[model samples]
Target: MTEYGRQPVERQLPTEEARDLIALVRELADREIRPHTAEEEAAGHFPRPLFTLLSESGLLGLPYPEEFGGGEQPYEVYLQVLEELAAARLTVGLGVSVHTLACHALANFGTKEQRAEHLPAMLGGGLLGAYCLSEPASGSDAASLRTRAERDGDTWTVNGTKAWITHGGVADFYTLIARTGADGPRGITAFLVPGDAAGLSAAAPERKMGMNGSPTAQLHFDGVRISDDRRLGDEGQGFTVALSALDAGRLGIAACAIGVAQAALDEALAYTAERRQFGRPISDFQGLRFMLADMATQIEAGRALYLEAARRRDNGLAYSKQAAMAKLFCTDAAMRITTDAVQLLGGYGYTVDFPVERLMREAKVLQIVEGTNQIQRMVIGRHLVGPESR
Candidate 1:
C-alpha cells in the first residue's frame, strides 16, 4: 500500500526508455547527491561538482541533439530523468530545468552558425545558463517589461535588470529578453548574453524560505554590448521565442513537481511503517491509508498530464494549452500532496529532522516558478475561449 493515505492506481508504469533513465538517475542521486542534500541546503550553496559529474555523465543536456554532446533523448525520457533528480534533490532538478529553458532559444531560434558556435559548450563541461525574462516590474506580466536593448551599428547595448534569475552570477551564459522595438510583447527580442560580458553583474543571492541551494538573484545588464549575431530569431520575435520556450519549460517543472511528491511519499511510507501510533503502526490506520491513496492518485494524474503534453509536443501537435494545464495541475497537486505528507508526519514533518518539511517548502516554489499557477490558468482559459476573442 502507498503511504500518505493514497490508494494505488492501475499502476501506469513508465516506458522502457523512461525506466532506464529513471534507473540511471536514481543511481546518480543515491551515489552523488542524497548524502549531501542537508549540508548544501543549510549552507545555501550549490554543489558545483554535482553539475560537473552530470556533465561528464552526459545527463546535463539529455534532451538536446547528439551532435552537441547531448543524449538527444526524447521529452518523455528526459522528463523522467528530471523526476528522478527532483525526487532526490529539488535544487538539482530546478537547476537542470532552468538550464534547459535557457537552451531552448539556441536550439529553436539561433541561426545555424550560432548553434554550431555555442551548443557544444552550453551542452558540455561545467557550463550553466540563466533565462532572463522576468524583470522587477514584470513578474507575471512579462510583456510589460521595461528593459531595453538598442541597436548601435553592429552592436546592441542592453540596459535592464532581470529579476529572480537562477544561476544569476554563476552561469556561463544567459538567454536574455529585452525590448528592441516598442512597448509591448511584440516589440521584444531575445539575445544570448555571455556571463563574462562587460557591464554584466548580479545582486547578492536572495535569501529565501526554501530551495536555498539554488541561488536566485537579480541580474544587471548595464550597457552590455553584443554583436548582431547574438540576437535570437528576429527583432520582433522574442515574445514568440519566450512563450514557446516556456511551453517546454512548464513540462520540466511538472516533472520536477512529481519527483518532489514522490520523494515525500517515499519518506512518508518509510516513516509510517516504522512509526507507531496507539501502539500500532500508523500505516495500518484507515485514515492514513486513505490519505496515502489520495496522494498517489494526484501524483499519477499529474504525471499523466505532463506526459500527454510531452506526447503532443513530440508529435509536432499543438500543446500550448495542454502544457499550461499540465504545469498548473501538477504543481498545484504537488503543493497539496507535499503539505499533506508533512501533516501526516504529525510534528516530525514540521522539523528538519525529517525530509517532508523540506519537501513541503520545495513544493511551494513549483506553484510560482516556470510561470505561476495563476498565469497557467489564464493561458489555459484564453485557449479555451479560442484565439479570436483575445
Candidate 2:
C-alpha cells in the first residue's frame, strides 16, 4: 500500500466500479508487493515473476481499451493505481508505464489485422515490452537520431545503438525508432522487433546509484531484420507517435514521483513517532514536526497537480504542457521529500538499514528519465510561447 493507503485519498471516481478496482489493487499491493521490495532491491534483482503476477491480475493494461484485453480504465484511475504500485515499489510501477508506452503505437495506429494478431497478447499475456527512443547521443536532440532502417521491398534491416533502455535484454519485444530517410524528425520510422531477433543484443546494464531492481542498458541492432508488416504507423511519422506516447507517459512518471514522495513521508512520520530522542519521541520536537508537515504538504500538492493533468488527458484535451509541468514538479518534489526523510532519520537514514536511503537514490532518476527536467521546461515553454522556427 502507498501513503495513499495510510490516509485514504478522497478521489472523484466516475463509478463505483473504479472505486472497488482501486481498493483491490491496494489490498494486493500491501499483501504481496511491499514485502519483497526491500530485500530484492538490496540484492539488485529484477523481479520478473512479480510482473507476471501483475499481468495475470489485469494490472498491466489498465489504461487501454477493453476490447484489446485491457481494463479500459481512464488515466485518472490508471495513474492512481500506478501511485499505489510505486509506493509499494518503484520498479513495478515504472515497468507498467513503459509497457503501456511500448504498446501505444500498434494499439493506436496499427492496422486492424495487427491489433487482432498482437495487442491482446502484448497487453495481458504476461509479455513484457521495452520502448526504444533515447539513443546514446540523441536523447534530447531526438530529431538527430542516426539509427538506420533500410527497407527492401518486403523487409527492413535495422542497424543502430539505442542507449538507456529499461528492460533492455529481458523484454519480450521492442518498439524501435530508426531513421529511414532525410536528416530530421520526418525521416524516423517505428518498427516492432522481437527480442530474440538475430544481431540484436543488450550490453551489460549500467551500474547506477539506485533503482537496482530495474535493468537499464544499451541495445545494439546490427542488421536485425523484420517484415514490412511490423512497421508501425507510416514511414517518417514515427516522431509523432513517439511524442504522443510520451505525453501520456509523462503523466505516469508524475504519478510515480508522487508515490515515492508519499512513501518517504510515511517512513519519516513512522520513524519520528517511534524513535526516541532525549528521553521522549522525536515527534515531540518542534523542528522535526515542521519538517514532517512540509513533507506531507508537498506530497499532497504533487498528487493534486498530477491528477489535474490526468483529468485533462482523460477529457481528450491538450495536456502536453500540463503533463510536462507535473513531471517536473512531482519529480523535484520526490527528490526533496526523500532527501528530507533521510535527514530526519540522521545517520540511520544514510545507511542501508533504512529504506529512505534507497528511496532517495531512486528519486534521483525520475528527474532524468522520460526526458530530463530541463527538457520538461523546454516543452512547457514551447507550449506557452509557441515553438521557435528552426
Candidate 3:
C-alpha cells in the first residue's frame, strides 16, 4: 500500500519538555495511527483501542491540570500535539479535541470534590467523552437549545435530544447542557451524565462524507437521572461554560485544520515530484510550483494564527475573537489546500486510491464544525463593532 504519511513539521516549542512531547506524539501517530487510517476509515470502523492507548499514554488530556491525571501542558503545546495527530488521521485528532472539550467544564468549574471524583478517569483512565450542546433546532444559536432538566430532591431528571454529537454512542461520559429554569441562555445548566445512564440512548451514527471512523449521532435523554453533585456550575451558567469551552475548542479545530491542510500539501508535493508530464516532473512546471507554494504559505499562516491565539489563551488574555478568526481562516485554508491537492494529482486525486480525495472531504467538515466560518465571521464582527442591533 502507498504511504499517505505526513512530512515532519518544524514547530517552535517553548521548552525541551514540550519538544519531547511533540516527538512522542509524532512517534505514536506514525506507529499506531497513520498505518491503519486508510483501511479503518474505508471500513467506517472506529478505532476504540487506539483511544484507549492514547488514554493510557496520557495524550487524552494534555491541556488540563496534572493534579487530576492531566498532562498540564499549555494550550500551545497541546494544540501542536493535536496537529500532529490530525495530520495522521482526523478521527483521532478531532476525537481528542472533542474529548478535551467535554472535560472543560468540570476541570475548570466543578468543585474540588467533583474534579477529584471524576476527572482522573475521564482524562486518563481510558474513558472517552462527548460534548453535548447543539440540538436539532439550535446549531449556531446554541442559547436557544431546548434540552431541559428538572430538579427534584437533589436529583435531576434530564429529557431532551442532543444532535451532532461526536463520539456520541461510543463515549463513556457526556458533558451535557440543558435548560434547568428559564427559556434562554440564563436558564441553562451543565451536567456530567454517564453514557449508560438510564434513558440515555444514541441513534445510529450519521452517514457522513468523510471521517467515517468517527461516529456522529443524536443522543436522546428520557428521564436520565443525575445527582445535583454532577452539575458543573450554578444554574444559568451552562452557556458561560459552553462558550468558554468553545473558545479553546475553536483553537483545537484551527490546529486540526492546519494539520489536514499540511497533509494535503505534503501529498501534492509528493505527487508532483513523481508524476512526469512532457518528459519532465510536473513539479518543475511553474504553475504547479506556484500552487504548491501558495498552499504551503496558507497552511503556515493558518498555523501561526492558531498558535498566536493559543499563546493568548495560555497567558490568560481574551482570545475569543482571535480563536474565531483562527477557526474561520484555518478551516477555509484546509478546504482550499486539499482541493488544490486533488487538482495537482489530476485524475488520480479524485479516486479512492489516493488520499487527497479523502482529505478533501474531511477538510469540508472542519469549515462547518466547531463553528461554521460564517458564524466565525459574525463572532469576529461582534467583537469589533458590538452586537448587531435587533
Candidate 4:
C-alpha cells in the first residue's frame, strides 16, 4: 500500500538490465529522496547534496551514449526511471529532465571536439545545467525570442534576459539561444555558456505556488562572451535544435506527471484506509472507492501513452504527434487526479500536515512547463490537419 512505483504497472521492459535498473531507482528514491522531501520542500531547500549523490550513483545521465559518460539506456527505460523519481519528488525528476534538455544540443549536434571536451563533465561530473529559451516576451512563441548574440572575430558577445529559467542562479552551465540574424526562428543560434562567465547573472527566484524547492528565475547576459567553439550546431539552427530537444522533453514531462498523480493517489489511499469513517475505512465508501478507481485508471493510461511514444522514439519512428498527445493527456490527467485526491481527503489534503496538498500544487506546473497543455493541443491539431491560418 505504501510502495512507490509498485502500482501494478505492466511494464514491457526490453531486458533484465532495465528491470534491475528500475529496482535500483525505486530503492534510491525511497531511501535517499522520499524521506527528506517534505522537510526540505517546507524549507524551500534545493538539496544540492542529493543531486551530487544522484550523479555519483550514475542516475543523472541515464539516457545518453556511454562514450559520453552516460548509461545509454533507451528512452522507454529512461522514462520509467523518471516516473519513479518523480513519485518521490518532482524537484528531482523535473530538474533532471531540464538538465537533459540542456545537454541535447551539444550531444546531438555538437562537433566531436565539443562532445569530447564537455560531455564527460556534463553527464556525470556533478555539474548542473539550465535551458534558456523562454524570455520576458517569448514563451509560447519561443521563436520570437529577442536576446541577441553578435559575433566578433573568434568570439560572440551576448546581451539580453531569459525569464523563467530553472536552476537559474545555481546551474553550472546554461544552454543559451539568442538571435544572431533577422528576426524570427531562423535568426537564432545556440551556445553553451558557462554559469560563472563574466556578466552572467540571475535574478531572485520567483515565488511559486509549488515546487518551492526548485528555483525559477531570470538570467541576464550583459555582454557575456564565449568562443565560437562553444556554439552548438550551425548558426541560425538554434530553433531547430530547441524543437528537437522539446520532442524528447515532452515525453519526460508526461512521465513525471504520471509519477505525481501516482503519489497523490498513494497518499489518498493511505489516509482513507487508516482514518476510519463510520466505524470503517473511508476506502469502503462507494463514492470514494470509485474516485480512487478513476485516479488509478488515469495513471495507468498516462503511463502507457508515454511509454508508447518513448518506444516509437527509441525505434527511430516519427513520434512527434504521439508525444504531443501524451504530454497533453498525461498532464491533464494529473491535474484532474491530484485535484480529486485533495477532495477525497477533504480537509487534511488541504493542510500541510499531509502530502496531497503539496502534490496538488506541484501537479499544476507540469501542465504549464515543457510547453503548456494548450501548446500541446496546438501541436496535435497542426499534425492532424495543418498549421492554422493567420
Candidate 5:
C-alpha cells in the first residue's frame, strides 16, 4: 500500500511521520527560504525570521530527544530536511547544520543538569548557535590549538582567539574548544560559552568568497569566565568530543553538498530547456546533454553515499570512514556539478544574476569545513591501514 509497491526498494522513503515533517519543511522552504534568498544575499542579511519559523515549526529539534521539545527523528530523516533546505538556500542549510553541531556536545555528553538548562533554548529558539573549534593556525590540526582555559578555583578563565567561526558574532552561544593543559588533543576541554560573556568579543566579520550572509568571524576570548559546570565533559576530553561531533557534522555537510549539486542540476536542466542555441534548445544538443548526464550521475552517487553514511550513523555503526567518504565525495561532486552547471549556463553562470555561481562558491567551503577533504582522506587512509598499524 506504500509508494514502493512492486518495485525493488532502492532505499526506503521516509516513514509516515518523517514524510509529514518533510512536507512541512518543503512548504516552508518554498515559501520563506526561496523567496528571500537572493535579497538576503544581496543585502548581507541572514534570515533570522526563517530560523524562527523553523523553531516554531519544530524543524530545528528534528534529531534531538522529544522530551526536550525535539522531534526525536532519525539522522536519516533529519538530513533529508537539511538537503531540501540547502537546495533552496545554502546559508539556511549551513546555519541549521551548524546549530545542530553546536548542540552535539550537550545532547550527547552533557550532564543531565546541563541538558535541562541549555537544550530548551538551543532547540526552541530563534537564536542560532555556533561550534568554535578552528583557530587561525589550528584548522586541520585541531589538537594543536593554543586557546587557553586556566582554572580559577571553581571557575575557568578562557583566554585566546577563535578564528573562522560560523555565526561568529551573532550566535547566542558557542560550544568552544579550549586548551586546559599542556600540548596536544588530550589536554583540550569543551565549554558552553555564552556569546555575551563579558570578555568574549568578536572581530569584524570575515569577508568570505561565499556564504557571506552566514557571518564568519574571529572571536577573542579575553579572560572569559565560566563555572566548572559549564565544562561539557571531564577536563581534557574536548578533542574527543570535537572529533565525535564532526562525524555527525560531516553527514550534515554531505547532505548540504548533495543539495547544492541538486540545485545546480535543476538550474541547468531548466536553463537548457529555455536556452536556445544552434537553431534549437541547448538541452537538445548532444554534447550538452552528455554534460548534464554526467552532472546528474555525480549527484545521484553523492546522494547515495551520504544517505548510506547517515544510515550507518542511525544504526550506531562505526561510520567515521563512511562519513569522511561521504563528506569528501559529496562535496567534490558538488564542486563538479555546480561548476558544470555554470558552464551549461555559459556566460550567465559566472555572474551573480544566476545562483549557480553562489552554489559553486558554497561548495568549496564544504570541502574545507567540518573536516577538510585532505583530513578526510587521512581518516580513510588510517581506516584502511587498520588499528594494528598504529
Candidate 6:
C-alpha cells in the first residue's frame, strides 16, 4: 500500500516568516492531521481538539489584525497556508475558511467596542464560529431569505432557519443574517448570536458524500434574542457585509481546491511509479505520462489564478471577478484532476484503500459550496456585463 499524503510543494512565499509558518503547518499536518484523516473521516468524527490546537498556534486568524490576536498576515500568505492544510485534510482547511467568513462582518465593520470585546477570543482564543445566510427556500438567492429579526426595546427577537451552516451545532458563535425591515437586500441585517443562546438549536448534520469530519447542518432560531450591540454594520447593511465576506471566502475555496488536486496528483504519480505492468513501471507508458503532465499543468494554472486574486485583495483592489473566476476554474479543475487520478489507479482508485476516491468526493463539494460554480459564473458575468435587465 502506498503511504499517500502531501508532498513538498515548492512555494513562492514573500517573507521568511511566511516560509516558517508554512513549515510549521507542514509539521503539524504530518504529525497530527494526515495520519488519522482516513480513519476519522470514515468514522464521521469532527476534530474539535485539532481546531483548538490551531487556535493556540495562532494559525486560525492569519489574515486579521494582530491587535485582536490575529497573525496579521496578508491574504497572499494566508491563502497558501490554507492550501497546505487542505492538502492534508479538507475538513480542517475549509473549517478555518468558514470561521474566517464568520468573523468578516465584525472584523471589518463592527464598532471598536465590539472588536475589543469579541474579536480576541473569536480569533485566537479557541472559539469556533459559523456563518448563517442561506435558508431552506433561499440558497442562490440569499437576499430573499425569510429569517426575521424583530426589535423589541434594546433586544432583537430572531426566528427562522439557516441551512447548510458549516460549523452548525459545534460553533461557539454564529454570524447570522436575517430580515429586519422591508423585502429584498436592503432589509437584511447581520447579528452575532451565541451558539448556546436560548432558542437556538441545530438540526442533525447533513449526510454528505465527503468531508464528513466537518458538520454541515441547519440552525433554528426560534425567538432567539440578542442585544443590539451584537448587530454588525449599520441596519440594512447585512447584504453588503455578506457579499464582502463571500468575495474573500471564495479565494479560500479556490486555494483549497488546488490543494485537493495537488494531493490527487501526488497520489497518481506515486502509484504509477511503483505499480508495474508487463514487467515495467506503468509510468513508463507515453499515454500515462501525458495525462500526468496535463494534471500538473492544470494544478499550476489554478494556483497562479487564485494567488493573483489574493494579491489583488491584499492590495485593496476590486477582485470579485477574479475571485469568482478562481473559484470556478480551480474547483472544476479539482474535480477533473481527481477523476483522472482515479483512472490512473485503475481498480485501486475505485476502492477506499486509496485516498483519491475520497479526494474526488471532497472536490465535488468545493464547486457547490461558497456559491455554486453556476453562481460563480453569474458573478463573473455580472462583473463584465453588469446586472441583467428587469
Give the per-residue lDDT of model 6 (tens digit) for 252-360.
9999999999999999999999999999999999999999999999999999999999999999999999999999999999999999999999999999999999999
TM-score per model over all chains: 0.95, 0.96, 0.99, 0.97, 0.95, 0.99
Q: What are the per-residue Cα lDDT tens digits for candidate 4 across 96-203?
A: 888889999999999999999999899899998899999999999999999999999999999999999999999999999899999989999999999999999999
lDDT of each: 0.87, 0.90, 0.94, 0.91, 0.87, 0.95
Which ranges of candidate 1 are over 4 A from the true structure? 1-18, 387-390
- For model 5, how many clashes? 0
Candidate 2: segments with Cα more than 4 A from true spot:
1-10
User: For candidate 6, what is the lDDT?
Assistant: 0.95
| Model 3: how far residue 74 lies from native, Å | 0.6
Task: Choose 1 or 4, whichever is better by lDDT.
Answer: 4
Best prediction by lDDT: 6
Q: Count the backbone clashes (under 3 Å) in each candidate.
A: 12, 0, 0, 0, 0, 0
How do the residues 23-85 of candidate 5 rate in per-residue lDDT, one tens digit apiece? 777788777887777778777897777788888888787899987767889999888889888
**Each prediction's Cα RMSD?**
3.0, 2.0, 0.7, 1.8, 4.6, 0.8
TM-score of 5: 0.95
